[model samples]
Target: MTRFSANLGFLWQDRPLPDAIRAAKAAGFDAVECHWPYATAPGEVVAALAETGLPILGLNTRRGDIEAGENGLSALVGREDEARAAIDEALAYAAHVKAANVHVMAGFAQGQAAHRRFVAALRYACDQEAKRGISILIEPLNHYDAPGYFLATTDQAAEIIAEVGAPNLKLMFDCYHVQLMEGDLTHRLERLRPIIGHIQFAGVPDRGPPDAGEVSYAHVFKAIERLGYKAPLGAEYKPGGPTDDTLAWMAAYRP
Candidate 1:
């Protein structure tokens, strides 16, 4: 079976952390992850994992620590200091939770200077974060949902990862975004499997629960299994109903 990670950010937006983890486990999931565990302490995350015996697959670094009103940090951003600071804080959070990966958001930083700044920052982030035994997973956001985002396609992300040539840096293969940009799911997965550091998804176009959309994840997983992908398949979708309503998807999703 393909191990699955519930994305708490989308499923339990109003519930406590423990409740979310417990819910995932109750629904027969083995792990859980989220975008940001806002206001939730790192100890709480560790304790939740302990209580439910479920691992947190990963989470994002504090996007500007919100209280500081800082925007998200990505490699393509123009602010070197901000991007570096974001990486440092993310390293600490990962250490606290003993996480092996962090989704490094490369938000919009355009123009010649912005492009140059992003390239340099990516190199610095990988070099600095490698000390913790954790790697930076770069994601290319879609043009529709995240307009002006710097890294908007896997091809571009793969190019940058190849250029930086860091052992700790790799591309995050988000199915929804990739489907929107490229649509060749299985073939792309086969080609990019080597550089892929993490994978996530939502129903394409709508970003809702998989069963409620046009993207047939059952076939997708079957194809992924054909390639022998044994890692967690991340459930990073917006719940169409209650979080538990998504439990039915697992019944038909075979690896």
Candidate 2:
């Protein structure tokens, strides 16, 4: 059976983070994930997880200076200090909340210099999280939604993962981004299965509920299960309206 995780960043925007966790539980999601829970106390998140008995799968490192159009810090040439600080902060928070993975954001950058910086940052993050049993994930964002984003393709991410050479370093295969950037989901899933730590999805073009998407999630979920990915897939989509009204897609995949 396929399981799903509610991405609280989009699913329950109106509620408090802790309340959102409870809502995900009531919605029949098997697990939960978030964007940045830094503002909310880690203790509150941990308590909610305990109450619901649902694992928090992953969270992202701080996206530095959003006002300045900065999406991430890890790959910026001169921001090594700030990048490591974000990584440390994320790992510390993950430790407190017992999150299984941290998606280290590689900011808008290009060329060999950016590549070198991103690899170095991932090495540092992977080393720090290894003893804690936490994995480090890198994701490729589509150009339309995240123009100039450093990580922009699965092939690029896979190459970086190979260069970093950390056992815990993995790829976050977000289907919405991948479909926009590179089609052929099932083949890519098969080839990248070894290093994929987490997977996410939303409707193409609209980024809404999976039930009304260009991509058929029903078929995609079967491919995921066949590939032996037992972890709950992340539902990282915009709700379009009230989140509850968009969850009819979940009924078809629930165990």
Q: Estimate, for each residue in 1-255, the C-alpha lDDT of model 1 and write its tens digit.
A: 777888888887668876888888888887888777646788888888888888776777556555744446654444667778777777788778777687777666666666567667778778877778877888888878877777888898888888888988888899999998878888899999889888888888999877766678888888888888787888888886788866677777843
RMSD of each: 2.2, 0.7
At residue 54, give the lDDT of candidate 2. 96
lDDT of each: 0.78, 0.95
The alpha-carbon root-mean-square deviation between model 1 and the true structure, to one decimal in Å, is 2.2
lDDT of 2 by residue, 1-255 (tens): 999999999998999999999999999999999999999999999999999999999999999998998999999999999999999999999999999999999999999999999999999999999878899999999999999999999999999999999999999999999999999999999999999999999999789988886899889999999999999999999997788888888997664
TM-score of each: 0.92, 0.99
RMSD of 2: 0.7
User: Which 10 consecutive positions of candidate 1 have the poorest summed lDDT?
Assistant: 69-78
* Model 1 TM-score, 2 decimals: 0.92
Segments of candidate 2 deviating more than 4 angstroms: none
